[model samples]
Target: MFSPQPQYNSPHNQGVVDGIISGCKSFCLQTSIHGFNHIAAPKRHWIERLLWLVAVATAVWGVVDISLGQWQRYRENPTVVTLEKDFRTWHYTMPAVTACVQNRTNQDKLQNAIKSRWNVTPESHPTKYLYYRRFVDVVTSSDLYHLEGYEEFANDPDLNVDLFELVVELMPEQRVKLSTAEQITTPPKWTPVMTEVGACYTVNSLAITDVALV
Candidate 1:
């Protein structure tokens, strides 16, 4: 992020600055002297004295300003540079963090509400809500997948009501332990129905509240 022209701390570097000023002064003096060559006699002391005085004044002003602590403030205060860096960072870095934190906040709020309503902690699990949102966004993207068939049944409240009935039926057996030491489980066969159901489950788990539609 280099600026086209120098601005901060100092306007110009010493090398080009002093050299150009000196060169200009020399050229002016030479031109003046050459002009006077045409004159039989001319008073040149006044012009030389004025130029020397102006140059000295400029040098003294620079020294005084540098001594007074104006230069270092710009040096020490990176806020201006940081402001630039932040502008760039926001353009590139902030959206992902924002989405993640937002999802986490919503998840926490939802979990708390569920606990308060149930008088018990709902099943404790780590759910990446942002990921679920991304998956849902992908599935719903019309250009990517029409997904129209899924959406027809996806919004059904009666389906959720029926599923909740199964949960209600199993509530009595909730306390029982199903794990047995010798048994192992393999992934279920990936049928089309299973894929749709799994996607729905993932989407639902991460949602702050279930949307019921018919």
Candidate 2:
């Protein structure tokens, strides 16, 4: 007579099956509890939300204000040139200024004025006028050429106010005329019609006596 065989899962297999069933039940229970808790949690009152929003905004504003203050501290002061026209002369003073690019623009404006006075244009003696541009850069870049405050200028034992005069006297047109041989032999030495006063003492607070220039 034949006997029926009995199959049984190994202990390791049984343990795995039991663990899977237990884990599924635990996961389901935890999910249900989590769902209920989330539903039961009290909603934030409108006033509380508004307060939180205000707090966040205030924090952001504080950060921005601090950043702006730091930036202002490190940033360079504006280069301001005050020009006054009295009688036949144009008197200009830059109380506090640097040799940065902004000041460079102010310098350009003065150069243009001089150029206009001399009637210097690309069409009229282009090569000759170009030399003035090169010469002006060389002369102004020197430390001695930067302008100081009026006080410093006045106190200087060796004050040359005449030299500070911004004037471009165009030499007689006949004098500037050069022959082909002279042009080839000499890289024409040029004198800048406009000159700058030496570097000035910088002050944090400058008075605006004339707002017209502003």
**Model 1's lDDT to the true fold?**
0.37
Output the lDDT of residue 176, model 1: 19
RMSD, one per candidate, in order: 24.2, 25.2
Report the lDDT tens digits of candidate 2 across residue range 123-153.
Answer: 6778846655544443333334443323333
Q: Give residue 43's error in model 2 in angstroms.
A: 98
Worst lDDT run of 10 residues, candidate 2, spans 166-175
Off by over 4 Å in 1: 1-44, 63-70, 79-214
Candidates' C-alpha lDDT = 0.37, 0.41
